[model samples]
Target: MADPTPLSVFDDLRAESDELDDAVAELGPERWALQTPASGWTVAHQIAHLAWTDHSALLAVTDEDGFRELVEKALAAPDSFVDEGAEEGARMPPAELLARWREGRTALDQALRAAPPGARIPWYGPPMSAASMATARLMETWAHGLDVADALGVTRPPTDRLRHIARLGFRTRDFAHVVHQVPVPADPFRVELAGPSGELWVFGPEDAPQRVTGPALDFCLLVTQRANRADLALRAEGPDADRWLDIAQAFAGPPGTGRPAKGDAR
Candidate 1:
């Protein structure tokens, strides 16, 4: 699949955020306090993290120096910086947190839109284009939105927006292995997924010996570490591809302790 235009990605990012907002707009304080699957994180923390990241992204786009400060703080406490941001935001009243998220995301949108043509944005990972930054934001909003839904005992119907995530998961195939300290695959793997709307999404050459095929929802969940592999319907046709399924992570940073199968004790 071709890379989506930054404009389209920014639009989708807004829609994804709006959808998550609708899900929690009416939530009571008590519900916000409920813990999600992420350890030590409540439903509020999920939203807080999104808001915090959006703010950081804004800084990255419009104020590189400020963004670097955040980088220094993160480097100073690699293990605690993420949780620290989430924890600080999660401590606010539900109303305040929601307002901050909405406001911060709007500012980020404006900053990204105004970024000079051909300019690369500083990020936690390697510098990338504005479109890539937007895609990363969309990916995270959707993933954390899942945790919020689970906490609320509601199911978010799958949507074509997952295509962005599916593509990311495919492109990050090698990064996944490298992060795990495993050898990066010397050759690309072919990946085929059936999108939520029944569209075919194919990546890599058809003749590639390694292949992964599955429902797009399952692939996104696996790559995001939102669900256990044993619980997903994804199938792999090569040894390396199979191993990739075991450790595939679309996001940067340390690999997560993914969810356990339904049959396993938590």
Candidate 2:
């Protein structure tokens, strides 16, 4: 069978939502307030943010005027908008918040499916094609899902779905450099990851001198800022590749302070 298409990325998004929901389903109120690895955010805040974004994404597609108003409001209070939204959402009853999240994601899925092939949707970062928007949603779901998993001390087994994230990370290599005002590498780095199923997933030129080689899960985690790059067994073969690993981020925003290596926390 062929690999999933960009449009099919929504299947992966649904899978992530299901897995994360299942993981958090049985938590009591105390567990809801447990802090995640994302500083200043509890488990509830994580889900709340996802809920808000999914709803915002729906607005972006179906109601441009409302979405623009939202953008203006967000810009007016740039630094605190996201945190404030999540904090406000956390005030809902835990079950209510979960229901709202489920509903918002369901609506988002419907909106994306109904969107035309070439449609572009505005977002907090860049405006995105329908497929790109879906993939971004998937990436965020997986990244925050990791935080929720960690807070619960649960080890969620990785799946081949990480291939989507790894691909996004590699494609964003130049975005990573450009955002930091660093010069984009003239030559692209080859990326070869051993997929969870043991298939080789290769990106970039096989003959490229600069290369990143590792397990797909590790690369995904590294790009999402969920794992410390130093702790991962990934190898970089050239100066550009090495520097890319040090600053690679799959999500948009200012450069992130990545997680610390195990046993190295302050």
Candidate 3:
């Protein structure tokens, strides 16, 4: 896989955001209010949550003290703060909500690009470099966009941009284990994914015994917890690679209770 610099990752961020914007723009009231696969979250909630986080990310990079204060206030509230914010934000007029999201993400992209070299930006979990932070934003947008797409019964065509998400999934292996309080694997796993554009994306040492190989899109969906491992065509060899597939989460935070198997309702 070709290395994606932070600057190149920003292009992916913009592209993903544009894709989501176009999707939401074609929706009407009924569709906007439709509940997504994420329990209790409507399509509106997903977009609202994306807008809210983009605004928050902008503040984190541009106004440290203010962002810190906001974070503190949010922490003082219940664990439902994020969800509550999304629910309330979703109540706005759809046009207004969409506009807010567009503006917020635009500002966030600017903030990230303009950040001084080597600057570390604070996040809910930890400070991240601009590239990592931008990739996280991409991952969130893609994951939430999947919810919206699923709610609409639409299939989002896979893209090579998924390389960023796949790389994040591999890079966050340790963080995933730590967040779940599972022992971090002493060994590393090799990830070899065929990108949507038919490019090969590889990670970890070539000699690693544990390996994951599959279509990049499937790997992205698996890591984001949007698709069940059993439903994907991904192949995992060795104990650690198989186990990681059971609990991989590209995003930071507690371990996610992943979606059920394809045919199961629960």
Candidate 4:
């Protein structure tokens, strides 16, 4: 399949958010306060973080200076800023929190659509095209939605939408090494993922000696650090590739203190 267009990714973002909304829309205050697998974050915190990030994305797309201020705040409180954002939004009544998320995400969709073709948008990390921004948002929604689903003792079936994240996980190979203070491999590693729909998604040289392969769902979970690698079904066929699995993270930040392996907590 061809790369997803900006409009298509924007559509996917809407769908992902809507699906999450369906999960949480009718929750009572008690349900909203239920703790999720994300350490201190509650169900409300998951949605609030999404809403807060959506609003931040909107500012980045529309107001570079404003986004810079947010970046400054993040720099000043690198460890606590993300939690702070989620906490602020989570404090609102559930109904208001939901409304804010809906409004902010809808506005972001509009802004992305109106953006001039090929224009770059400012971001917490590097500037990105509208399509990349939409894809990043979709990836986050799916990951956090998983936390919400787990909190509710439910499951969310994987979707081909994770292809974007899988692609990102592969593309960020060097980034993963860099963040871990490891030198990037000189040769590229091949990656092959089976999409949720069973479509083959391939990246890198077909004949590369180093390779990573897995269900797209597992790769997405691994790179997002939502599930511990030991609990996932991914495989790495080279030393560097193996190390990539150990530290892969698609989202920009300090290394995530990823989830513990199943049944092993200290």
Candidate 5:
């Protein structure tokens, strides 16, 4: 299947970042420190991490030395870097964090816009073109924003713009294959996504028989392991369908242990 258009993905990244900024801005100080659904991070830490990450991502994309330096900085930061950053963040309040986040994001955006078409940039994993880097950032912000929302018992208004994040799920098939030590599937299967607004996104050949379908938010949560697939309405059809669902991953790096079983939520 053809890859997503670069401009579309870039637009999604900007929009998702802006939405997350708004959500963070709305939280009171006490709520910012509340523990999130993510195992080890609090709401404040999640926001701080976004700031730290965006800065790091920009360095990684622009200057090789700067990328290495940031990694060294992360290694040297206190064990509670997130907490420390959050503590510092609290002093400035949400408005400040939102400002910092936007400034860092703007720098990255400028760099991305300035890069020549097809120019490759260094990333934490494999090098990616500017377009891919922006898409990755979009996925990261959206996933982490979910953590913050879950902690506060707030639900983010789902947007069709998140199709970019959903598209990443399809691209990460290779990551899943490697994590499972299985050969990549040569025959493409149909991926039918039901967005939060009831919009459908179809990937792969029109005639491909296999199908995966569910609410876009649920699919994102499942793939990101923020929620269990059983909690979602997702379903698979066709011979190899179950297996694909079993190992689907939408991000770079290793496979996560799937979420606890349906009855085990605690």
Candidate 6:
């Protein structure tokens, strides 16, 4: 794998956000109220959450104290925040919802551009650099957008920018270890990803004997827990290979309960 380029990472984020905007705009009002594959979240709820998150990201970039206050506010808000947001959103015509989404996204874009290079921003979990925060926001939008598309039976095209999201999954290998209380292997392993666009993204040493490979979207979905790992064609070789794949995660916070492996469901 070549050295990970920062410029490429930024480009990936830009592309991912743009694609998500297009997908969200394409959904009709009926589809916006439709239930998504994610438990209890409708398409409107998804967009609302994304909008709320962008607001949170802005706070992270500009005001850490305010960000914490907002999280507390969300927690203190009505237990039916998601339902309320969805219902309110459902009442809006498609154009209105799309307009709100665009407005929030524009603010997020401005926040990303204005943030200092090394700024450490508060996140839903640990603090992260401005770049990492932007990356996280992009990943969430794309991953949730996938849920909306799946609910609507619309196929989203692959984008080169997914590589940015994939890189977050790669970096989270360490977080996964900490959450699972499993020690990561000190020995470096090669990571080669075939993205949704059929482009190969590699990290670690090119010649490293151990490797992880599969469809990029599947890999992203698995790491995000949007899809079961077994549904993906991921393969690992070497002593600790299987263990690493077992707990792969892309997001911060406590480790999630991964979906059951194929044929293992009750």
Question: What number of clashing residue pairs does each candidate have, in the order they appear?
Answer: 0, 0, 0, 0, 0, 0
Off by over 4 Å in 5: 1-4, 69-97
- C-alpha TM-score for every candidate: 0.98, 0.96, 0.97, 0.98, 0.84, 0.84
Query: lDDT score, residue 202, model 5?
Result: 73
What tens-digit string does per-residue lDDT give for candidate 2 at 1-266? 24569656888888889999999888999999999999999999999999998988999999999999999999899788888889989999999999999999999988898898888898878789877888888889999999998899998898888888888999999999987788999997899999988989999888998999999999999999999987898999999899999999989877888999987956
Name the candidate that leads on lDDT: 1
lDDT digits (tens) for residues 125-194 of candidate 4: 7889998999889989999999999999999998888888888888888888888888899999999989
The predictions' CA RMSDs to the true structure, in order, are 1.0, 1.3, 1.2, 1.0, 3.4, 3.3
Superposed by TM-score, candidate 4 places the C-alpha of residue 113 at a distance from the truth, in angstroms, of: 1.3
Q: Which run of 10 residues does model 4 get worst, by summed lDDT?
A: 1-10
User: Measured by TM-score, how close is model 4 to the native structure?
Assistant: 0.98
Query: What stretches of model 2 exceed 4 Å from their correct place?
Result: 1-3
- Ordered by lDDT, highest first, the candidates read 1, 4, 3, 2, 5, 6
Cα lDDT for residue 47, model 1? 96
- Candidate lDDT (C-alpha), each: 0.93, 0.90, 0.90, 0.92, 0.76, 0.74
The digit string of per-residue lDDT tens for model 3 on 130-247 reads 8888999999999999999999999999888888999999998888878878889998899999999899899999999899999999999998999899999999999888888888
lDDT: worst 10-residue window of model 2: 1-10
Q: Model 1 over residues 1-266: C-alpha lDDT tens digits? A: 46567788889999999999999999999999999989999999999999999999999999999999999999999999999999999999999999999999999988888888899998888998887888889999999999999999999999988998889899898889988999988888999999988888999999999999999999999999999999999999989999999999999898778998999987
Summed over model 4, clashes come to 0
RMSD of 6: 3.3
Candidate 1's error at 198, in angstroms? 0.7
